[model samples]
Target: MVTAISGFEPTSLSLVAELIGTAVFAASGASAAVGKRLDLFGVVVIGTLCALGGGAVRDILIDAKPLVLTDWRYPLVAVLASLVVFRFHPALSRMRPTMLVLDAAGLALFTVVGTLKGLDYGFAVYAACIVGVLSGIGGGILRDVLVQEIPAVLREDFYAMAAVIGAIIVSVGARWESQIGHWTLMLIAIATIFVVRMVAIRYRWQAPKPNI
Candidate 1:
């Protein structure tokens, strides 16, 4: 466990987290497609965008080849998740609470992963925080845009705020603790985001909306 964390190597835990995140994001995308009454292919397209678009954008900004293109496993996981949601959306629709939990988990993981990737590409801490927030929110933003809706982060609860806090913790924590285990860092980041988001959801918390 320490070795996996120390070297920032892929571990079973991280793999599972990544898979869960991919599935949740794909479900969100597929559900949006279903709401729009789009075809199967369209559902897949949206799912791909939701599950992989943020990472792709991050990689592009970092001047690296997108991981989704290089990683067959990533796209495979995405399409399979999209298909399952497409076929079983009726049953799945009843699982809104479960979906929210999964969404929170994904949001947490994405923020950490994005921040790490940004730092890896030589970004400053503040820039990496911004990248992390963008990566956490980008996929959903794209989905909302395609569906002709306002993005949730802009108008909704503390969605982006949670990402900001988690990412900031990650950047600062790593810098403060040179020996901090990567897995430990990742876990801290995930827990921070999930706790903030869940609490916000439970309390109906909202950022102040300015009257135009």
Candidate 2:
């Protein structure tokens, strides 16, 4: 009796969103590696870690096989994206704004996708929300840690908060699917996360810190 929102299928929107998120995260990771002057092999390794680390960890927590292990397409997409970024990163590095935008998009998509998948696996709404946040931030954490940098989620950019809010929207929406339609709820969540993160960036918003 673990019914998810109607039409939230792996073969549909969720799958497409995950794939796109993977690509963007991979590109971001590859770009970071290139910035650090890593060789192509290191770049691809980091890209794959950034792309698959989150979903892989999520699936493991849910006691399911990671998608990257089962699906050929997932790693393939990550590698291709890394290669693309590696090839054009000089131009891309110059476009910091564009990279930030894509990073936000990936975060939003992964938040929604992870929430949906957690629900599909019969997690309670609250747990599903946590999974969503993990999915949104895990890649960046792995990427940053590998490069010996602080993870973006630990920074003062409202990054993880945005993911938390988006995950809550999706979790609540799942319960209210009849009232708001699944697709509409998901789109709203994505837009809300994107807007919140972008605005935080624009305003230099930060969570209150100890006055020490």
Candidate 3:
């Protein structure tokens, strides 16, 4: 059973998760910018959006100012991560496994953060679930928009599904009043999403297209 650390002060685990998530998303955004041959400024803009978009949307929905706006560290982290990836593109590109792992970690951390924030705002379970899913995919969606491409959420992978599952787990766990259950649910949700995504990639899993 996962333990609930929702009310707990920022622990090393939470901090690490946040940093890792920011880094992974930033890298992904930077990679897209590079593919588009975007200038340095464009890279920074997209990377920063990818790192903070989800959380910002979640906060707005919950009637709070975005956390990234209040804390400068988040953008600093995103920019630093983007620079590191940009500096070592050749070596970093080879670390596909590491990138995927980091992406999964980020998805999990953000999903939980979104769900918890929604609950804090006194939203019902359904609303919380929506917020959680949005928080998980919001960054990627923004990244795609900046690139003028279709969003990943509407494409072949289980991206949004993973977030939905995670949100459901978090919502259910919260209802149980068991911190352990909550955390366990969160962990499971994250793991499930990671595994599903990896497997989908490995097997070329895709959703069916509409028959026009």
Best by TM-score: 1
The residue-by-residue lDDT of candidate 3 on 1-212, one tens digit each, is 13335676646777778888998999999888877888888888898899899899999889888989897878899998877766776788889788877887788778877887788788888898899888989999999998999997788576677778778877777777564555566667677767776776677777777899
Colliding pairs, model 2: none
| Superposed Cα deviation of residue 75, candidate 2 (Å) | 1.0
Cα RMSD for candidate 2?
2.2
Best by lDDT: 2
What would the TM-score be for candidate 1 when compared with the true structure?
0.93
lDDT tens per residue, model 1, 1-212: 11223444576767788888988999999998999999999999898899988888788887878889887888899999999989999999999899999999999999898998888778888988988888888888888888788887799898889999999998888775457767678788889999999999999899898889
Residue-level error in angstroms, candidate 2, position 66? 0.5
Which residues of candidate 2, in runs, are more than 4 Å off? Answer: 1-14
lDDT-best of 1 and 2: 2
Could you tell which candidate, 2 or 3, scores higher by TM-score?
A: 2
Count clashing residue pairs in model 3. Answer: 5
Q: lDDT per model, in order? A: 0.87, 0.87, 0.81
Q: List the residue pairs that clash in candidate 1.
A: none
CA deviation > 4 Å runs, candidate 1? 1-10
Better of 1 and 3 by lDDT: 1
Error of 1 at 164 (Å): 0.5
Error of 3 at 102 (Å): 1.4
